[model samples]
Target: MLAPVLRKIIQNKTVMIERYLPSKGNLFVQKGDILEPFQKLGDCMHSPNTVYFPKEFEPVKFLREKVYFQKGSLIGKIGAKKVTADENGYMSFDEVSGEYFYEDMPVKFTLLSGLWGEVSDVIPESSVLIKTVVAEVDLVACTPNFSFGELVVFPNPTEILEKFYLESFVKSTEGKIVYVGHYADLDTIKKARDLKISAIVAGSADPVGFSFAKSANIGLGVVSGFGKLETPDFVYKLFNSVAYRHVFFHGDLGVLRIPMSGVEEETVSSKKKKTPLKVIKKVTKGQKVQVLQKPHFGKIGTIDRVSVSSIFVRFDNELGPVEIDLPNFFIIE
Candidate 1:
């Protein structure tokens, strides 16, 4: 029998990434220049003009529909306390809803290299292209988004620990890519969005939570298919080793990329050429595989025997040898 091959990780793969600004901005790196993860790449002034409606804001009666105010100017009162403009902005009252909103001015956004690499190309006033070697982890499913941030790996959470594990890292999670646990529920996804987490990596996710992530524009990558599943042992160990490193999550490509160190890159460059990666392979006895169905979902086992349409797998757990349909398992490469 033939089966699909799931490559959990590819080490020392060369890749190019483009770091750009939303608008035209200054470029701080040139071709062939070495870049560090914390180095500033460029900056741009852009107006997000975010609208805000303060809770309990009660506008003064007979106030103009729209008014401009300096910082600290009184807008209204919240209960017995006065509510003032937080910044120089325009406040407009919504006649239909009886609410008010403030819009602020342009702000500066600085771009960081976010990786250890060399500048391969530059797009003047816009972006810099970098060439780097990295270790890549495959994701079975992910939202359509792109994010780069410091990777934070947490221990796999038990049912009880999952509820409170994220709370412990509340202060440090903002703008970071976090590995929550083996399974993420809807509440976990909602909490991550509220905490401003850049992305979430999990072994499996609740289908509803996955849908919410897409709608909320949050990055979510799953190593295993949906529903409660354990993270593959190899993937967990790899993440633990790279914790705190700058990483890239390409949800559209279904991969998490961790840049390799300069020494590691040089070592890979000196090694003999490797053969092409195989995506399909013939099923045989003693092959490692992962079950994709219930009863043994996400479990890794060794094939004991292969038939025309089924394979008997030997798991370390007491389940002993079990026969799994060919389509219910995939070779783990």
Candidate 2:
């Protein structure tokens, strides 16, 4: 019988990533240029403190292009009401567009390559596309968001230890993607959000906490099924080995991507000559499977025997082989 195969982890897959700025910015790399993870790609002046005024508003003679103004400084009027600058910035009037705008001091933002790759394409003053090889981990459930940062893997924590674990890294957690252990509770989710963490990955999460993450727009990815399930041993070990590596959390695609090294890319290129990995296969004895139902949800076991519509699986910790319906488990390839 043919069964669906779930790929928990895939290694050395080539992908293209586009890194862009919020506004028009400089591009430093050209096509075919090789880049390292720490390489600087470009920089931009980002201004989020801009305000617009009605076209009908009249401005003082002193309100000229590039004229600096401080908070509460009056520079114009809309009929009898006087308009003041809300923050310190330069003033400008666009005659062609008939628009008045106040912009605060722009913040300088530097862009990093973030991966080992070759520049595949570049859009001037906007974005750069890099072709790179990476390792991908499938997530069963995830919030619909996108985030990229250094991956932080914590030791599996008990309920009481969760807070302490978070506090230990409080200063370094901001803008990072962290693995919060076997299951994430509501308190853990709240603490992460407060710390300004970019996103969180867990083995499983409380449905309530998962809902909160979605509503709050925090990126959350679950590797295993929900409700108090342990992270599969293999997945946990893989994450532990790659702590502090640059990673991408694509919640919409339900995958975590970790860029691979140049040597790994070479190995992948060599393997391209071989047959590709399979995503579906015939059920057989001795195959590894992950249970999707209660009693053994998220547990991995080896198939001992295959029946007409069920398979008998043997768990290392269980006393005897357990019969599982075909639909309740999937082959882990």
Candidate 3:
């Protein structure tokens, strides 16, 4: 029983995005191929590449810092006998590609080249890409003090960001998310001064609604498309922010931007959940007891439960659990 319940909870939920430090941004260069003549760098800052972010980029995760970038794809490995750039206002990179070292590296490029160039693109104003994991544990084989490996669910990632704060899970918890679901008012934004949740998931921030998970320093994601708003596009934007490299899709469906570790699933054996308490002693195996003003002139009823001093019983015609006071209490059957 517990196996199925736990499986359902884990299966139905998708983190979609995880938070990271604010992107320092990334390095990018124009001139097409790496060997393009350095003079062709007519303000390489004008060119932009498609950057894919991780699935957890929004909603679940935040950028802790602003992003930084380099001019060329080569990361600091240019060889010894190379010509360095000192006048183009570009920086030098000692980067090794394939086999040889390339020296000159550009300094900065437009952070939003693709965003600005593709007039038709409906880039997300904000979003996040998250990674997910399915953890398995043998309920029967483990005790309260036992290890479930990596089964501990992550905290409400939104709580870790500066713009967003965490809330209590039990106060009016909708489910497992501790600090989500209901949110405080934007006027209370100052109240978030001490919160630890990440940025808000964009667009969903309606302080007036029941589902409004208020966003603060934490990230909040929203939907955006070429001309409309769509959930998938909103998610994709997060991936681009992840991969300033614009290289491979982390996922098969042209979805990359995330570097995931320990993403594999595990198998485990489990057992059913038993009732908290069982019948300890009974006067008869099947004969349930009843208290009456007179032994034979009473009504028949069903035993709902028992306590130290009384038994809460129910009858076929009754509306609710009825208490029967008794000097001593125990299961009759």
Candidate 4:
């Protein structure tokens, strides 16, 4: 009985943390060092520098020739226009496609510890594994990527992330993981990226905008299912409770992790004391659930009865109980 309940606990005792070195170099900390979210972990030298210019240029020679260009020197010609080197850099050409790209001089790169954890193991100069306690919120949908930053909250989830709201918080959003309210569209997402926001959390988003987040490589996590849904009150409260804390958004794993702080320990303890309820559990009377259908999509309600193939739900929106089929409701686990 407890095994099924334990499965509902999305967060566990330990997290596997990975930090990448741009190139192999010195590992700053050895195994067993306690790490903070922003501590320097390692450093590397001679990281690749890639420059992509407009597609109008036509190269005179292929990159297989391994040519070098001086600063402010002409490298290619686009009809009457000459393409000159912006800086002293090596040039490599893709002979197969007849395309060339300029590579700037490599520079030193520093790697930072992304979360509060203990170094469980070290892979020499390459990477390290860290283990720590965390609280995770499962995202309904998300883009695949990893990001970490201080969590910033917006006051209202009903208001769409419009231009003015973002403009008001431009300074606060820079390099931070911002929680944009319900239903962010493409324009808002583009504006946030322009501001260099590290990541975005929202209740729901349009499919086109969500796809753009994926293509742009912006970290995004959707709390509720997509399309115009206001974030549920419970989820909003959870975010507010952890505002200003550092969070890790692991989109590929569908979890937004809030590493346990002293204040968070009490909250975690209280949750553990409560009986765990799972979304995949067999429907039982009086179980609270979120409805996922027309006229009640994203609304929370209570289970009234369970049949062979359908369960009756008493929604906050409806006057009487309504019948819904299996998999159409998610328990508020």
Q: In lDDT terms, which candidate is top?
A: 2
Q: Candidate 1, overall lDDT?
A: 0.84
Best by TM-score: 1
What tens-digit string does per-residue lDDT give for candidate 2 at 1-333?
Answer: 778887777765458999888778888899999999999999899876788789778877645567888889988998999998887888898777778888987899889999999999999999999998787888999999999999999988988787898999999999999999999999999999999999999989989999999999999999876888777677788798779998999998899988877776565434232237676889999998888777888788999999999999999899999999978888875
Estimate, for each residue in 211-302, the C-alpha lDDT of model 4 and write its tens digit.
99999999888877687766666667878887888888889898888777445555664554324544345668887677777777776677
Task: Write model 1 residue lDDT over 1-333, tens digit each, in one string.
Answer: 899988777765469999998778887878999998889999998655646556587766546466777888887787899877778877887776666777665589899988888999999999999998787888999999999899999899886786577888899999899998899888999999999999999999988999999999999999977888777787898799889998999998999988887776555422222347667899999988999866888888899998889999998884668989979999876
What are the lDDT scores of the predictions, listed in order? 0.84, 0.86, 0.26, 0.75
Q: RMSD in angstroms, candidate 3?
A: 22.4
Screening candidate 2 with a backbone cut-off below 3 angstroms (N, C-alpha, C), the clashing residue pairs are none
| Cα lDDT for residue 285, candidate 4 | 86
> 279, model 2: CA deviation in Å?
4.2
RMSD of each: 5.0, 5.3, 22.4, 5.3
Candidate 2 or 4, higher lDDT? 2
**Model 4, residue 129: C-alpha shift (Å):** 1.2
Quality of model 3 by C-alpha lDDT: 0.26
